[model samples]
Target: MVTRPASPSSRARLASARGTPRPDRQMAILLAAEKLFAQHGYHGVSIRQIAEEAQVPLALVGYYYGPKSELFHAIFEHWQGTIQERLALLQQVLAGPPTEAFLRQVVEAFVRPVLVQRASTEGEYYAQLVGRELARQTPETHRVLTEFFDPLAHSFIDAIHAARPGHDRARAAWAYQFALGALLHHITDHRAPTLSRGRNQVCAPEAAALLVDFITAGIAAVMPLPSSLSPSPTASPSPRRRAPSPSTTSRRQA
Candidate 1:
């Protein structure tokens, strides 16, 4: 019996099957999973599909990363540095008591990383994944958000509050959400170019400056809730009126 050399195509399949070993293996799975999860909702995709898409053995997916949820999480962990970058920028902006300028910087810090990522080929899938998860509001998605983002939100929200002292906390909080909503919508919104009749790209470079400007003014514009309206739970309580003295009441009666 004679052993024969494998064909190039056979070797290629073997290479994909072995899956680049270590870091590359994990990355291939991560990228495949990210694209699939983004295109189809989390529930809509499966572990086997990811393995096939990545062209790695099914068990290796688990061996390298674990279950589907963990793979989903790995995607975020892969990009954790971006969150840290934003946090660092945010802290710098927040170092001085927040000014109008700080508000713009804060908005830039919050929007730029996500926007730039969304604009890039490498990050496009991850951006889409984010948009879908937010829409689904699934338990897994909430878990990820809580683990990775809640702290960031609190920091930025506090920064916004610090930036504008006269405004109630509720206003500051809503303004944060509103700014977030604008960025999320802008990144995920597909109709912008069509809506603009080819005048805009979804991730146009100019849009970053414009987005920061728009969100800054919007944050600045968050008015305190009306006095007649009940205060938000976080709002400082209104003082009660002092009771009239009994002597004064008697004098009035007399």
Candidate 2:
């Protein structure tokens, strides 16, 4: 049987509740989970530890979230509002049609929220948690990536592809991947300032603009695939490996 979508009224109500002061029990569990998951990985964390950190009974953890994977997914589901804002911003930029500045616009759309999150108090834990999980690349993390991250990425990739039709699909894909990689790496690396001798920092307000400029240039640098590699009208014949000369073959066989 088909299921109806959530009504706008119900959605807004839920959003309001989530944004406001939630019950201590649930928020405690989620915060605990985020902390533990950030410190230890998904595999390293356990339901018991989460319960301990939350200061709630172990049963409550199970009651609130059926399984560890579900709980992990819930952490992301809790943050859907931020993701929605990013998508909305991207959609607005896309509506303006392609231009020379399209790549910069797309990069800004992707990078701004990320940098914003990196700078905010609540967002610090979230950025760390997300970066750690992504780096871990465990089976559960893979599930999260597919369920939440890939679809969002695909949207931006499509926008990038549309903006630069001259580039091949492979290059467009690479550009998107590179841009995301840079963003995530910057967020995850807390030692950036120390490592750079205090010359560079990743979480500054202007960081997003700098990243946008760099990423847009990187995306633009993808050279088109060579003409020889392009598909031929008639099926291109595969090059045959030359058979060894009879004398050389006989000598080798001997």
Give the clashing pairs for model 2: none
Q: Pull out the clashing pairs in model 1.
A: none
Per-residue lDDT of model 1, residues 5-64, tens digit only: 455675565566564545666678889999999999899999999999988788667666
TM-scores for all candidates: the values are: 0.78, 0.75
Clashes of each: 0, 0
Candidate 2 ranges with C-alpha deviation above 4 Å: 1-22, 223-254
The residue-level lDDT of candidate 2 at 230 comes to 36
lDDT of 1 at 82: 85
- Give the lDDT of residue 186 in candidate 2: 76
Per-residue C-alpha lDDT of model 2 across residues 1-254, encoded as one tens digit per residue: 11123456654644543455336878789889988988887888999999899887676566567689878888888777777777778777866643445667778888887777667766777888987777665777776676667767767776677656556646666788888888887777778689879987757665667778888878766733235533366745322212111111111100
Model 2 CA lDDT for position 240: 20
lDDT of 2 at 173: 66
Where's the lowest-lDDT run of ten residues in candidate 2?
245-254
Best by lDDT: 1
